[model samples]
Target chain A: MNRRDLALGKLRGLGNSIIDDVENNMVPSIKVPSRGTSNIVYDEAKRYYVLGDRYGKRSLGNVKQIKKVAQMVSMGNFCKGLVNTEKTATIREMYYVSEGWDVDFSNQDESNLIVEDLEVTMGISREDLGLMPEEDGASVYGDLTLKDDDVEINAIKSGKSGYSISPTIDEIEFLDHGVERVIAVETMGMFHRMVQEKAYKKFNCLIVGLKGQAARATRRFIKRTHDELGLPVYICNDGDPWGFHIAMVIMSGSAKLAHVNHELATPDAKFLGVTASDIINYDLPTDNLKDIDVLRLKELSKDPRYRDEFWQNEIKKMLKIGKKAEQQSFSKYGLEYVVEKYLPEKLDAM
Target chain B: MNRRDLALGKLRGLGNSIIDDVENNMVPSIKVPSRGTSNIVYDEAKRYYVLGDRYGKRSLGNVKQIKKVAQMVSMGNFCKGLVNTEKTATIREMYYVSEGWDVDFSNQDESNLIVEDLEVTMGISREDLGLMPEEDGASVYGDLTLKDDDVEINAIKSGKSGYSISPTIDEIEFLDHGVERVIAVETMGMFHRMVQEKAYKKFNCLIVGLKGQAARATRRFIKRTHDELGLPVYICNDGDPWGFHIAMVIMSGSAKLAHVNHELATPDAKFLGVTASDIINYDLPTDNLKDIDVLRLKELSKDPRYRDEFWQNEIKKMLKIGKKAEQQSFSKYGLEYVVEKYLPEKLDAM
Candidate 1:
């Protein structure tokens, strides 16, 4: 895709709110979510995508199991063939994001649509959502920096009761202070676990939620809290594609932050989770690993700047085994197994 | 994928002393085949991507269908359960794309490789070459229009030998005479159809090759020929991903042209053959489409410019009777069908 194509592709799914997010500079950098309610949720729902996520209640490599659970939840085959008592579920791409076509919606229900018209069902018509070249240079925020500490000051009350969390820089200034590791979790439920879960207590962590106005507000609070506290946050998310992408949002921010040099929420945050590699690390079943997940693991390994010693080591491990581990597999291991076999070994290694 | 990663992704197979036609200067464009007969054939064989022709062969859409045929050939999945064929042959992706352990030997084997990794393939590890992001911004000569006349130059010398067709602009030489719509086919088989098959008698066009070195040489000759004899060249190839990409490469020259905007190719070329939409339109067997194909179709239709009147009207004809038509399906109509439903009916509508 050329620069123009990239720009148009990025411009897709700019709902009034998302467009405003770009205009107002909320996330600083924004990308088409590979996870978390992407546009595919609406249009591609019927197609039954091979979902992958990196989110969950446990930071115990939950970021690595997103694809495993997503495959179970999103694929048509998984719906009928899946094991009845397993913790995993498959989800179609549309379940999490809107890819623009109402895959399940036939033109019969609406007069404006024609079932046979490829453009209509695919949202490719001239007036409607046609395939635009992907947007490349467009910014998520006017000038938000993924690596910058100076977040823009704008308070808008939203959601039920019109509530907003306006934690001033001064109020959250403690986040910028002395700290060793500031790990961030996307769910309060996970937060509850880290503070309470025996496996996660070894490291200093922060947990936050990703849904609703309250969740956004909490995310803002967490960002400020981490910044002021000077904590190096590690993100722990669900073990699915959606969860994996959500953590990335908190980590690198997005392309819009090309201007910012600081205000990074998690500049060095890594994919700390129950990765595919763990499947072999611990004796777990590997049936749920999809080609895409395997593909993603290889891709992450190939990335130059995105490469890290930890990932390099993990890639070496996968190469040795030719397999990956799913975090959902651990759910079967039981909470006791997680605490005993998984966490202690994992924390010590990290 | 980062810059370096993208550079590596495209260099999958580059060898031989053939100069990089797309890039103006010598870059890591071609890998010299090994020093054996097979090696020389393999090295030189890179050029015969598709067969070549001198005038209208098949269209890009048709070329795509051929590519799918190649993919099926490589995988040995063709006619798995086809009528009259009960024997099954399973194929793997690695066969055609040669990936080595923790890495692809084929990718490693190629030399003078100009293009490298892609952003789409970056998520995988090198050990298995499982999945990774395909490299995105490795600059190449063609992909999109960086130079208008470069496309023309390419058109002229596309099928020639012992010459490289580099787009050059002079004071008042070439512009004095603008060209008209002239079709350029990419295969000798397609060329056979024109002369022996009398395919050209049906339309005003040119011919190139459909395979290897001869095809590349034909393209060079086409571009250079057009320069010596200015003629607006329209392309007709297959419609599958590879075919679409080939057309794109010919149109843009390569991403390497990003540096010099003057000699870039043009984008006015038209697609005339089987397309992803045909799966929906012709009601043809869709099992041939890949998982990503559906998503891509959704993306293509969403482009704003595609929604415009001229393009939309042309695309809309596929639904003339609220039904889509596949080029392959036209075969069912047979040679008689070619005279009846195709040609006059099809081209007239277009």
Candidate 2:
């Protein structure tokens, strides 16, 4: 099924409904999935928030809904225009477009809310509506071929710079590739070093740079790559609470973006390093955990998502030791040690 | 004096001093301007933080200062590279650059600190060091010609879109032009509408957009425009505590950027609207002030920066009314009314 056609069909249906309501002298109403956790149910098996059996109806008769419907109609028209022109817009661009149309988005948050409303109402993602966030997160290098728009990109042959994963992951199509696994690095510095050392060649895996917390597009791409290629995903982050949370976000999904969790999350992705146990076992240089780090570790220890015994023990050890180590700490050994020795050892254990 | 020459000379001096220390078997030391209010004297008449008698010296003998000196040297060398190459870098870019150079900038804040240290130590601003924040805040439309690098830009004649004020404001040289005043708006939407309506032509003033909180560059530009061009500046923001702070940041200077406040703050800039008084006087649509708004309002009521009796009364009245109005609320009077009626009325009152 073509998503553009589906989006266009939704817009046409809305237009017809509005036309019918005007002809019959009736106030039109739009039924959208209600926002927030109240309308979302946590699916334990799926490890994500799915839409609950609850819906919000916006009627033109109500003053607020009248404005809402006007905004919605404007957005629908805008989406229709995007499809017709074969163009894409970032969320910021969408806000500016709506602003130009006099649809009063006082802040980006208001614009985001309407976009979310549109997503729920049409049962379509924003990406399908030709809307994307600013290109952020995920840098890839490995034996993978990707078709971004009309251009086929050979990730492995893209030189030292690697391919920047697009935010519009839905628009990307993967070609047959020989990549065996995917390793996602939290920091760009580490990712660059891995590339410089040609770690991907040795490991027969794609190296994906998360660049701190993984963006939605990065997570989606990772999930798709894993699912489509039957590749195991491994996360390498700092041996800190923040790093643990990053891995948690990839595996179980983030609470803030729970609405799109199932699509974004790679639940089977494994945490490789730098783990708290690795710091002691490898005799890595450590820095005293700051007050904030301790607080975060304590919170993560109490979090249900981190209830696994290994994770619990790691957090406990970090708290007890009052120290943390970064992925860069492996640089103390040598530049090549992280890619050559540390990563190889971790993979062997796995 | 050329800032690059000054920066390079300072770097050379530091290098020679270290060499001298090694020869003499003495610990190397550096004197930098001490941070915080304790070392910052608030100049009431000037409305900025001036360096006090106290200065902080980092020495190799001290464990903490050793790390601080190392970070500072790394940053200084990085700035030297930027100057040598005649290139500009955003704060984030500087962080990444430092990471590439093996400087441990774990986060942006750490990088920001080193930048600040360089500023204080060398008696030079980040802008002078060829460092800028990301391009943000301030859009402009006026009878003004700006020389950004070699490209000449006529703000008034630059098509209907107007000119976005660049983050590298230091590089912008204003050509001889006639403009009565500068009106800096709080939001981009309002600024765009004002441009669309040709409000600048009607009022014979330069319109500058401060998108939400004004960025340092925007503030610096506003200040320089006021100083060099001798234009009275007027700030128009929402009638909320945050809006009040934005105005405060413009007039009295922010504590975080105290060192560069004198260069950035337009002390004579007047707050035009939307004021709490305007809510009552104009009978504007008001939303119930959230807990955060109330809390901010309460804090502003106690802050020295907001000590103006009129400003105090306005905040007090907002707390009493339990309501706040956005700048967008003027849309109730229609789009053209803000430019034609409300602005004229406010200007008349001024």
- TM-score for every candidate vs. truth? 0.25, 0.57
- Candidate 2: residue A266 Cα off by (Å): 24
Model 1: per-residue Cα lDDT over A1-350, one tens digit each: 53223323423432333347548866322221233333212112221222133222311135553333223122222212222211111011112111122332222222112211212112222111111111111001001112112322211101000111221111222212222454444333233233224222343333332331122223344455455545554555544344555665455443322111123234445556655456556666444446785676566566432355765776566545655433333534432354456655765666
Clashes of each: 255, 0
Q: Over all chains combined, what TM-score does candidate 1 have?
A: 0.25
Candidate 2 per-residue lDDT, tens place, B100-123, comes to 555477777887988898887777
**Candidate with best lDDT:** 2
Per-residue error for B97 in candidate 2, Å, reads 3.9
DockQ in order: 0.01, 0.04
B263-349 per-residue lDDT for model 1 (tens digits): 223344454545445445444422344557544444434533244454355334433323332232332322233324444443454
TM-score of chain B for predicted candidate 1: 0.38
Report how closely model 2 matches the true complex, as a DockQ value: 0.04
**Among all candidates shown, the one with the greatest DockQ:** 2
